[model samples]
Target: MSPHAELVSRLRAAWLSGKTRPMEYRLAQLEALGRFLDEKKQDILEATAADMRKPPFEVEVSELSICRSELNHTLNNLGAWMKDKHVEKNWATQLDSAFIRKDPYGVVLIIGPWNYPINLLLVPLIGAIAAGNCVVMKPSEITRNVERLVAETLPRYLDEDCFAVVTAGVEETTRLLENKFDYIFFTGSPSVGRIVMTAAAKHLTPVTLELGGKNPCYVSDSCNVQNVARRVAWGRFFNAGQTCVAPDYVLCSVEMQEKLLPALREAITEFYSPNPRESPDFGRIVGDRQFQRVQALLHSGHTAIGGQTDAGERYIAPTVLVEVQQDDPVMQEEIFGPILPILTVASVDDAIAFINARERPLVLYVFSSRKEVVKRVLERTSSGGFCANDTIMHMTIPSLPFGGIGQSGLGRYHGRSSFETFSHQRSALLRGAGRETLNTPRYPPYAPHRLPLLRAATETKRRATCLLL
Candidate 1:
């Protein structure tokens, strides 16, 4: 049998045996998982570097830090997050306690993505574990080293009955989805997300999709163009532009694009030196396939500056493309590489119109000091979230909901959102005989006197307080 199928069967058997029932055991497993990650920090970094040529420092800051912090957050908050919540009762049900019980959706599946592999996989795992659900984690096969590390390392530290990692490509994923899971958390492209959702619909399994979109950065005339260039350059080229929330493209006036490009070049030189390939601060495209994809996008347009490539090293220089039309392929898709396509527009209003025309992005960034212009953009455009005078910084805050909308993707997860995603809040109420007075009116013995009384009692008003059962 296939490895994915076997893993599913093992998880199913574990669920049947009730291995996920004990809260103490679940918490222990979570703590162990964190400890295991801490113990194997070097191994995680090595594997990530092997997969993407990612720098050691980046592995620490982007992947490991997020993983450790989230695990820590879960460890510190799990008990409280798991505690049953008491809700206020209304007069109709005042005799009984009204509470919200958060129950696990058993046997969850987590499909992790290639970018930030460890963090993407483990964040959802923390949620599923905290919510008391057995998890089947599928690390992205594109990142082979990290996938191997996860499949090998996770089982050693976690209870095989409660948490297991399945590593495979599309065929195995096809087979894995055949067996029903109560919940699935997927992070990837919009194209694959649709397939995941379609398969999930067959089982009616609840899903949380963390997907990507053509995230836009809008530069205005009011801001400091140099500072704007610095932040935008950092966000665009960070992770080799492989981040899902990376500013996919920029919209600004032709004059502004010209103004920003020189500053951006300066910023790039400051961050990674003029020879970025030789600089330790810069990273390469993830793999051959991604390298080729980004390289092809470079050929699609007029390159204003730094159109350099080395396929053998999987390196593309920090690129700036000008005279880029909206119809260009680079502008059409999520340019998940170091290429920054600058689309020139007349004004901020024109930029807003351009943004509103496309699928709503995951995060919208507007760099401007004018409060009225910022407010106008905020009121006009719809995104999963937005950041003012910045790019991709909103994602760093754990309090904000991070997920796409419409064609970009669906559902949000991070911090408390992650806990809520994995657990179903079941509303339950207990009532006593005193509330029985409310029930007698429904035993219809049609009469005129009863109509007036029923209308007076049941009529809902804007200023009236209501009770429930």
Candidate 2:
């Protein structure tokens, strides 16, 4: 057998042996993952910096800290999340005990993206572990340093029989997806998401796709321009704007655009200084291909602010483009770099229409002080998540589910949502053998008189009390 097949067989054997199903075992794995994060903080920081010139502080906050939080949260709540959830039943099922048993889908495959490699990969691994499933993690090969670190060090902290990291590029990933898995969790582009879903369909396997979109930021005239500029700049330029949920473009009135431009310029200067390319806090494009793609976009609209580039360093300055047309190349796809485009609209209704005309975004942001204006936008549009007067903060709350709608992506994971995503809620009904009389109504051999009596007994009322068996 091939190495990948053999590896999957080994994990399946471990899962079948029931080693990963125990609560104690799950807790141990989660704790080990937490320790892995804590022990390898410096290594992770250095690797990310090597991969993308990612700032050490940014790596710590966005990558290591987030993974640690997910691990800790899973550890604290694994038992409760794993417990059988009892569900209410009607009079028909009152005689039987009905509950949802959280069952792990034997073995899982997690394919992570290059951006935020560690966090995106490990966070879902935490869920798969908490759900008591064996995992095969495929870290993106584009981030070679981080991928190598994970492939070498991560297995030492995990049970080799239950978890393994496979490092490969496109060819290997395509082959790896050919194998059968109980579940697949992938985070990347929508085009690749379709490929993963298609491959999973062959095995009738389930999948969770955390894909990307051109997230829209709508700035209404009723809000604070300075605050809006600061928040928008932070969200748009964080990780050099490689985040999947980063605001792809801004939609606002011409008046608001005029006010926002100067405020945004000031915010950019305050955040990254006059020369952002030289700022240590700022990150570079991940590779030459990405650099070239973003370089081509700088010509889309008139550059209002920073528009510097260095091919050797893969540096694209934190740039803002104004007077952008809707059909421009920059507006066409998810600008996965440090480029922010602002498109002018006439009014709030026009902004909503402009957003609605495009694909559904992963996130929609509205900067407005008026609750009614925010409410109007929220009511009209659909997105994976929404933030009023802010950006990217909605995803920070673990209690809220994080996933896209329609074209953006499918499924959600974070906190309980993560655990639930990796779990199959098996509906169970248990009853005593002596309850034969109660089940008589459901059996065949129907009589006319019995039909009326059964209907009356099982029929639901507008205002009804629970009936005793």
Candidate 3:
């Protein structure tokens, strides 16, 4: 038997004991998680830096801080979130209690990606725990140090019986996925998402695939060039552009593209020094393989701004490519690196058509001074999320749901959405035991006299008040 089989059995036994059901128990585990983040601050920073040279500030904000925010938000709202939500009743069971029981799926599996390893892994763990499920967390082997840290340290803080950290490579992970899980949450590429989904189909287990895609950013000529450039640059280059929601390519008119080129150069220079390789603020690509993949994409178009590379260091300077062909290799896949490409469109209609023709992105960005332009694009396109006048900031808000449509991804989770994604809303109703007359409508013996009584008691009004919720 595989090593994880024993581990799965242990968690399943714990979950079956009903130990994870109490609100107090869930709170304690979540609080212990917050302590893990607080105590492991330095460890997390060092681990990510060792793995990818992620800048300290970037780790703190994008990785550590984001996870902390999720933990605290879940802690604050878990009480209300776990309570039985009373739903409106129809005429049939007016006296009966109707509610949605916020029940937890038994034991779940969460697979994290190498990029933003801590954030991606822990964010879903927080939700699974908040929803009162026992979880097995799998950190990516690609980020060795982060994986080691999580495997070694996280279990120390939380209850061992309810949670576990599984460290596995590609083959072991394939073997590991064969076991049954109540639910599975995966974060990575769409190709792997398909594999995970296929594995889940064997057990008929429900899954939330938080996959990545080539997100697009549209720049209208009406916007301020400098502001638009800075926001787009930040979104594209943050974490060295390993971001799943980073603006993959820029779509604008020739005039706007010309204006954006100089402004983007200025923004890149200001964010990272002119010599980005030496700058502490900038980060290196995670691995030699990833470095090679990103370096090859530079061949897509002539480098417009920066294209310097040091293979030994796995460092690629913040790069912007222009005159890029629609069929180029860089445009063919998500540029999960410090590379940005610009492609000119004749008009908004053309831009929308171009985007619509391809797979829907994780998030679609539009920068325009005209509200109608933003509104028009918003109305026309579809993505997991949308941001007007900015890029990636929409995801920082916990109130908003984050996921993709069609090929991009399959589920949404952030704050409340996270809780909802992990939770199973079980419909519940309690009727008085003595309601024999009321129970008769749902039972056998059909008669004319009972028809009017059944209709009055059970049949709902055709057009009642429209519930805004």
Q: Give me the displacement of residue 448 in model 2, in angstroms.
A: 1.6
Worst lDDT run of 10 residues, candidate 2, spans 452-461
Task: Write model 1 residue lDDT over 175-228, tens digit each, in one string.
Answer: 888878999999999889999999999999888888888989898888899999
TM-score of 3: 0.97
- Per-model C-alpha lDDT, please? 0.84, 0.91, 0.92
What is the C-alpha local distance difference test score of candidate 3? 0.92
Q: Write the per-residue lDDT of candidate 3 for residues 359-414, one digit (tens) a residue.
A: 99989999999999999899989988899998888867777888999888898899
- Candidate 2: C-alpha RMSD to true structure equals 3.0
Question: 401, model 2: CA deviation in Å?
Answer: 0.7
Cα lDDT tens digits, model 2, 183-276, are 9999999999999999999999999999979999989988889999999999999999999988999999889999999999999999999999
Lowest summed lDDT across 10 adjacent residues in model 3 is found at: 437-446
TM of each candidate vs. truth: 0.93, 0.97, 0.97
lDDT of 3 at 48: 95
Q: What's model 2's lDDT at 335?
A: 96
Candidate 3 error regions (>4 Å):
464-469
